[model samples]
Target: MQVRSLVSFLALAARLMLLGGLLLGGLAALAEDRPWLTAEERAWIAQQRVLRVASTPSYGPFTFVDAEGRLRGLSVDYVSRLNELSGLRLEFVAPEPFARNMEALRAGELDLLMSLRETPERAEFMGFTRPYVSVPVVLLRRVGSERQALMPGEPVSVGQGFAAADFLRQRYPDNPQQVETDDKSMLRRLASGEIDAAVMDLASATFQIRGEGIGNLRVQGDVGYAYELGIGYRRELALLGRILDKTLARIDAAERQAMVDRWISLQAERSPWQRRLLLAAAAALALVLLGLGLVLLWNRALQRQVVARTEQLRIELAERQRLQAADHARALAEAANQAKTEFMSQASHELRTPLNAVLGFAQLLGGDAQHPLDALQRERVGHIDAAARHLLILIEDMMTLSRIESGSLAVTPLPLQAGPLLRRCVELARPAAASAGIELRLDEAPLPLAQADPVRLEQVLHNLLSNAIKYNRPGGWVQVRAWAEPARGLLIQVADNGLGLSAEQLAQLFQPFNRLGRSEQQGTGIGLVISKQLMERMGGQIRVESQAGQGSRFILELQTS
Candidate 1:
């Protein structure tokens, strides 16, 4: 009674101690916003956020450096939103001119830069943000400047204007022009009858002419396509880049549309003919007919090509069907062979189990215990058990190989703690390691939950460890390690100091009955083959890295859940 009371007291004390520890742990966790990250995570973040950003002024009302030099713009707001979602901080720095901004980005003084026209040359060093705004480029003019415009029937000057420049360069090729300065100056020049009208971005002209108090300016007929703006980042922050991509996709579509409307609606007066540019049916009908003829001819040629491709596809499909039939036949043959092999293997193990028991009793019953033993009789009985044990091992290997190859092997995946799995594998292979006079060591860290079929994963680990031990030299060592790579997933490797494999042997390592050791070693060599198949079934893989005399390491990769 006294001993029972003492034990009860100890148990109560232990429960109270556990409860106290749990309370402390919970409080600590609740205090942290992002406690999931460790010191290593801080290092990773440092390596990733390696750049300051630069931007141009008046590029849009969206992006500009204010007098105090803090960044503010449409591009700025979008990037700020991006940072909020990604949890990665960036330094936004704006120095000066667009050319200087680009120079800073190229020289690595900044991590990213924004609000510049995209060119093939820029794509070489940077990645672009998702296009958030597309605006038309145009030149607004008063009602009287059409006939007096210089270069009227000459060629358009492009290379400097935005969308209109791009369109005229491609569409009319006859006339193009741009004002290097502000549209108001061009408007003054036009009001005073110097040049015809100013070529500027459509939004700029609208803001200059009406929103900012200049008069007598209105958009010409529909200018062209949209001049889309996108942010630019360096090429190396791929994960962060991908995160931004997903975040951008999640932003409300209406919100993006509102931003466009808010910025552009603050700025334009529609020209009278803007709504009627395509309203002339007689003129448009003639152009439509010409376009239709070309479209029909191109469509007719496309149909011919499609028909030829369809026929080629038909022939290729027939060839594929033939190959499929051949593959099916081969699969059936393999299944049948595997069935036979498994039956023989299991039968041998079962049959020899009883035979071994019988042979043991017979030898004991016929021994020199009761009377003088006949050496020949004892020897015969010993031979029966000796042969049976050897046969049993071979049978076991063949059964494993057969079931695995036939795809009848079951694989059940769960999130497993990595450290315990390695320990278990080492424990299972301990006897073999002892027999070889080799040391088996496991190097493990706190790893993530591995998505794996525990039984099959353990089987592969055990087989590798067993092989390592079985083929190793005396006093040799076998090491097993588990590591996690955020990018590459999980790695579990088993290495050995042993008689290593040749290139030819390595190539055939995962083939059934392929033994790398001499005839002296005890392996049917189906373990690796079975291991490979089972690993694949679980969406894991096994690969061997080896040198002829130095030894071999077999790496197993698993997805971390």
Candidate 2:
């Protein structure tokens, strides 16, 4: 009996010692005069009478109202701790909805809001505290969903004013969304099967499923983004934000973690049977790992053997494929060449027969001395002849394009007099310019001989001259200039004072059949294309420059001898 009394007395002494130490520690903490606060901050807090803080208790664990209708949650707990530590009086107002809270904060009815996302639009009226918490956004689906990913067409639900709503809209704008007033409403809709999916922060989803026991919904995956929560205050209260930041920085990591643990337990409680199943699964995994080691060693040796055999087969298969591919490519080339040759032959015959007839009859009538045709009759014949000649030129241009595409167009360059040839082209185009009431001006300086195919050079010059006259206004001017560059080569430019091209039109200027909105003009659309190709084949370059209201300039660069 004496030994038992001694043991009880020892236990009682231990309890008394622990209680005394805790009391002393509490008293010491309370005795701190200006702990973790600077003198300026203390003075500011003294002058600042009472800060009206507005918060919503609808968001559990973060902020929420209790049964007594008091604002209490993670944010509330922090407010209380901060007030006690700093000797600042913060008055908590009635619980308000999130939208109302923002409105009140903006209207100066409340000094600050507890926690909200910082967005660019909100920055216009309010300043934000440093991020205190980050909540990952998650994709929640029905429990038995087999989908590997969220489709853009699926119906989704998101909190109306959540930052995740903007993220979702950018990610899947085409998807239909049902915007709920809050996260709870979103989850309720998801549980009722009204929406296929809902995007919300992981913290709220966990509280709904684990804390509230809403078991029908499950988190499929994260939305790959997160919201950073912070204190929001009016822009006028910038100094207050700085003070809050300084105070929050003073809170130690251990105390902050303790506060978090006091509010949330992420891991849900498991039943006894479920705990046993988890243990059995762990044991099964351990046994499987043991057998897997032996199988891996055996598989490594067998894989080496199979790889050696596969090398020989792979080489043989590659050689056979290479030979077959070569033969198939050769056959395709032959077929394409034969088809092109046939097409060109048929096109040439079919187009020239009617053109030959029109040219033949018109020439005969225009030149006939027995009929002695009048001036008007002669002019009519001239129109027919010009039309027929234009048709013949179109056919030739098409044939040239085909040859150029097939790599069959040959360029035989010879020394040619640049000055005389350019002069002749200007002279030939003068009649067309005069008919169109456009002034054709030639500025020809003595230029060195150019190394180019004479026929192709003539074609390029004629097309540029004709296009200048055709697209010019009634009284515009076309200037033809030829000059020799010291080291670059000879340059020919055709500038027109007519409607110019835009940057977009200039980009596609040489594309085949791109008429540049001049479909009413009488010519094949491939003239510029043929011109560009002909210049390239003869080892020359062609380029153009134009502005919207000003006219266009086509520059052709040729090699000089």
lDDT of each: 0.64, 0.78
Candidate 1 has an lDDT of 0.64
Best by lDDT: 2
* Clash pairs, model 2 backbone: 57-64, 57-65
Give the clash count for model 1.
9
Lowest-scoring 10 consecutive residues by lDDT in candidate 1?
Answer: 155-164
Candidate 1 per-residue lDDT, tens place, 386-419, comes to 6766666666666566445433333545456667
- Candidate 2's residue-wise lDDT over 407-508, tens digit each? 434444545667766887899999999999999999989878777766578889999999889988999999999898877799999999888899999988
Q: What is the lDDT of residue 248 in candidate 2?
A: 61
Instruction: Provide the TM-score for each candidate, comma-separated.
Output: 0.39, 0.43
